[model samples]
Target: MTKTYQIQSYFNFLKRSTNQHGVHSPFVYDLVTKCFYDKKKYPAYQNIKAYRQHLLSNTTTLEITDLGSGSQVFKTTKRSISKMASVAGSNYNDAKLLYRLTHYLQCDSILELGTSLGIATQALALGRPKAALTTIEGCPNISAAAKASFKKFDLKYIDVVTNDFSEAINGLKTNHYDLVYFDGNHQKEATLQYFETLLPTITNDTVFIFDDIYWSKDMTAAWNIIKQHPKVTVTIDTYKFGFVFFRQEQAKEHFTIRL
Candidate 1:
């Protein structure tokens, strides 16, 4: 509980620590401005917002079954979809930020480790129309509901997998992920394992986003390992996410700029 409180405080501090102006690298600057700061409205963002709104409105509950490291927030076996949406789901700001990143990167292939109600998946899909996003959900029921929502939106190139993250990542033949979102396990060991497992899948342009970097001390240790890895050239600590990049051209630098 103390660790959780400390992490929350760090997050509160980070919410005021990083932003777009402090970045000087042309590439990073453009990314922060166009991706993080741009407020120009995209019609697709509205659809994703509506989907989230629907999730918030619905009060239906489901018998949630856990898979892939389980959840820290959910203490009981049964949970409401709307409660989960409002509690566990990514908030609007995070969704919009992801949307902007996908739009800026023009990423075609994306991998999402966790697909809770498909909120982030919808955001990514709406962010880049041409991107083919493969999101994994441990629970079949949740995946089913999310799949139905995707169908309702007529979203193409979005695949939902219901299986262990390890098995799914192992079965992957192609290693062409432009952006990988790690929102599954918050534990240090699992985080490191997933990072190592996905290491070979990364390209020079690959961008990996790890959620809840400060969730626990162990997670922070894992983040340190990820940042110090030889192949990792740059990292950005945006509090909610630790963005790792493997670009050969860029110098090794970590930015904790205020977002």
Candidate 2:
């Protein structure tokens, strides 16, 4: 059986959308055109896409012990890495969006909360070769697998931290991050905590992307709170994800864009 009616509506809404045409801000408009619309054939994209394919084909099993909010697709504690990759990993669209977001920002420093199979992490790294990517994963085995795959892809700037997301984030000294991707914990409390904790680190150009924004009503509530923050100038809701911008030059506005 399926869950979360908001997720259903969210997916449905995402199905009907175009590129950022009416995005009035010059910065966002250029980002949409140059980054989102960029069709340049990068060879690195093939490697990232193939990494997902390899995960989908893998039959070897790894005990999946979740540390954060548990998986919605898995009811049992034990699961195969292949099955987890097939069912629990970020979908192709999200991965591509991650790439676009990173590419748009041209972020020199990135903090990723989850490194599931390194799909999104690779996307972020490949989008910006100069970026220093620090990704946190709770599972050592999963993180090892991801690190090996990153090597295979020749992505060298990634620093995979195998630890609890909250602890790692708290211990971090480098507070300046051009972008932060929140995908480790889907719970409302954890999401809000991370948002508030990282708020002081953001600059006027910082962009924060939250995954599974409509996973539950609680997540929707969290997303609402994030959008209402005083420093948050603009928000774009794409059902599955919510993007927050801290640009001081822009007026506070929200757009439910179909992506």
Candidate 3:
């Protein structure tokens, strides 16, 4: 992470970003007011926090197989569970945002490309307990750890698939998903390839969320290309994540919001 680049990007985002006050799109306005700015302390947050704590305290070690852009913080393949959870897992705020989005949309079928420690997966499951979720993890050891967390948290709605992202995506039987989260691959080519491959599995109502859009210059370039796609009707850039909507009813528009 380049601190100087991030600081510059954030300042640029602030210059164009707005709250609900300036939003003209009705759907986006409602989302901003009802979901993004929602201050309700959901009860599910406690369980999510407890699950995170468990991972933090875990001292078990595992040999990680990283198929995506390797971690910037950790170079070694052998790592402690606590360290992985601390450095690789999604932060509380972003995980909560995922929870809120899942809950608000009431997504019936969700697909997650990455299941690192299952922290975000737990949030998604808690958000919509009835929703069927399939999360993919390339590393068998890490996937096993995530599965244990899911079982420990009683998050039975999620199905953990241990395979590379491309193979996992190819093996998916579902024709369409209500929500798709792209977090496994951070490189530009891989991210774009996944997006194109999954394009056919999306309905007009499908929502796609890309994590770490600003992780690298290439990731940002990929995000820019994705937002400009003909199928994408609306996009929201939150610095940490980039959200793509494919509503036929909505006119093509883009938003950069400060969270």
Candidate 4:
């Protein structure tokens, strides 16, 4: 992690980012008030916690094949499931946020670029039980492990595709997706490539989430370019994840919110 730089950037983000009180846009205000700040616990949270505990308790190791920007915490390809669950997988808070976003938006057809250990995938699957989720993973071993976890949890709606991000995106039968989560490649070129490839797939209500926008300067640049795209109507930057919206009814706006 770029600890020193990120800390500085976070301080800057704090200076610019606002709370719900500062928002004037009705749609954004409603989103922040209703969905982002909702405190009611849903039934799917139990399964999310249980699956996380299951991964944390497993001590099995697998050889990793990283095709994207390599891990920041890991120096070796050999890693244990527990370590990956702790360090590489999505944290509980972000997983819950994703669940809330999926459920709130009523996303029916979802696509995830990365499926590391199936932690986030499980949240998405449980968020909308009837939705069809297709998650792509570059590593065969990791994808297999995620598949096992999905089966163990009886999360039948998720389809784990073992392939590189580009191949998987190109092979998709339809470009339309209700929600798209990008966590596969961290490089600027790859990130922009995937964004452009999926640009046509986005409808007026489509929501795209980019993970780790502050992971690198290049990624931050990629996020900037994405926000500037003519089709993008609104964007919300929460430091860790950046959300893009293509609502035709919305005025073009960008927000940095304290989450």
State which candidate has the highest lDDT.
4
lDDT of 1: 0.84
In model 3, residue pairs whose N, Cα or C atoms come closer than 3 Å (at least 3 residues apart or on different chains), thus clashing, are none
lDDT of 4 at 80: 98
Taken over the whole model, the C-alpha lDDT of each candidate is 0.84, 0.82, 0.90, 0.91
Better of 1 and 3 by TM-score: 3
Whichever of 1 and 2 has more lDDT, that candidate is 1
Tens-digit lDDT track of model 1 for 131-238: 889998888888888888888878888989998788888766367899999997788888888889889889999999998788777778899999999999989887
lDDT string, candidate 4, 1-259, tens digits: 5767688888999999999998888988988888888888888888889999999999999999999999889999999999999998999998998899888889999999999999988888777888989999999999999999999988888988999999889877466899999998999999999999888788888999999999888899999999999999999999999999999998899999988
lDDT-based ranking: 4, 3, 1, 2
TM-score (all chains, Cα) for each model: 0.93, 0.90, 0.97, 0.98
Which stretches of candidate 4 lie above 4 Å from their native place? none
**Candidate 1, clashing residue pairs?**
17-258, 18-257, 18-258, 18-259, 19-258, 19-259
Q: Which candidate has the highest TM-score of all?
A: 4
Residue 210's lDDT within candidate 4 is 99
TM-score of 1: 0.93
Model 3 score (lDDT): 0.90
Off by over 4 Å in 3: 1-3
